[model samples]
Target: MTTRTPLTRARLATVGAELADEVGFEHVTASEVARRCGVRVASLYSHVRDADDLRALVCLLALDELADRASAAVAGRAGAEALAALAGAYRDYARAHPGRYAAMRHRLDPATAAASAGPRHADLTRAALRGYGLDADGETHAVRLFGGLVHGFVTLELAGAFDHSDPSPEVSWEWSLTALDATLTGWSTR
Candidate 1:
């Protein structure tokens, strides 16, 4: 017989996410998570199958939150405006929750991946591309391009890769978005 802890699964996951931010997702452990939550390791086992399951939950939470933000950011907008909004939202989320963002990139199981908010994210990106008058292949290309640019910028920014620049990160981000907008608009299907 397993004894459940007073803390709920949601609360445990939240604590786990915070610990991940402090100690990194790769290093997170059920023992550490238990300590952070003021509970025994055995108690946590009732709520989560294992460290991997907890990590998967964190990834799902992050993806859902990101998808919500992206949806709100791009609502009723189209073309460059939509693109900029989506990019900015993504950057903002990544900056605000680096650990959660890292968790979202983990290689989840196929069933978990299929049930994730990733598809909603893709749909949002696709909707934004509709303003560009792109074909199916072009839309796919645009999504990849946008993902690359956003992820690259955020990764570099988090690693302090642009700390020595004269222009602020914000300035660079805006300029990058502008360039992206132009590139998408002029993309040739050659």
Candidate 2:
């Protein structure tokens, strides 16, 4: 007889994330995860409260992973270099793990959100903007602007919005970063 590996929330979440990658995040159901795990759907309830709980676990996993990548990408770097690295981390992760990227946007309960890597992502953004020499309010504004630009661009790019566009998405990405750098450089003076 084969001994079965113990099932845990982490393992289930990992499987869910993989499923999301294959079938899209919206299609990651607890039944599907159980099927992949070779277990009954009812068994998974011992570890996760329900399908929503499983999705939330996957969301937490994605947030933690994204923050880790961003932290590493920005380490020992500042200004435009740090900005580019941070942005690149997001774009690359979204491109490579579209499902996990979608999971990262999942809404969590207040306590869960506060405990997740969501705050670390915020802190990393604020830290990365430190070299821009912005005041407190400026820092807050800059973080919002940076997130909006990168998220909007990546979302559109992933949807193939720039696939047939002229000048290439590569060219536009570089230009956008350059413009962002220039804007941040003059932010204090403005």
Candidate 3:
């Protein structure tokens, strides 16, 4: 006879996040999560509709954490300073939490995305670009450009793709930021 520990959506989400960190987000399962919590698979069904729901919750959690980090990094900063800070904050967070970082990219349903921290992320990006005086299209372009740069660079960095290089990634990262700043400066008021 086993005692069933009480579970909540929050606890289930936390456990799912931890499992993701251990076994890759794509491989995390409700059954495994239940195992970790010493509960039956059916027990998790009550807490989460299914595995997808668990992943969605983890994704939202990761996005929220990232928004918080970006908010702190960009606070009281503007223009290139804010851009660099935001980029660095994202890079640092991704490196620190690879699993959670991966989860942040997971696609959420429209309604789920509306309620997720993803909007805050977009707003922060727009805020950082405000000092450049870009038109709506320009801001959109810059957002996509910068977002792609950060995500691609971090993904490559984490995959050990830079391990063969002689230039330390630290140096490369700074160089990339410098280039990004220069590009933004050139694009401003254009």
Residue-level lDDT tens digits of model 2 in 83-184: 999999999999998999989889999999999999999999998889888988899899999999999999899889999869899889999999999999
Of 1 and 3, the candidate ahead on lDDT is: 3
- What are the models' TM-scores? 0.91, 0.95, 0.94
Tens-place lDDT digits, model 3, residues 1-190: 9776579888887888888877788877888988999889998888788888989888988898899999999999998899999999999988888888899988899999998999999999999988877899888899998999999999999999999987999899889988987887788544
Best candidate, TM-score-wise? 2
Alpha-carbon runs more than 4 Å astray in model 2: 188-190
lDDT of each: 0.87, 0.92, 0.89
Q: Model 3 misses residue 184 by how many Å?
A: 1.6
Number of backbone collisions per candidate: 0, 0, 0
Clashing pairs in 2: none
Of 1 and 2, the candidate ranking higher by lDDT: 2
Worst 10 residues of 2 by lDDT: 181-190
Ten residues in a row with the worst lDDT in model 3?
181-190
Which pairs in model 1 have colliding backbones?
Answer: none
Worst 10 residues of 1 by lDDT: 4-13
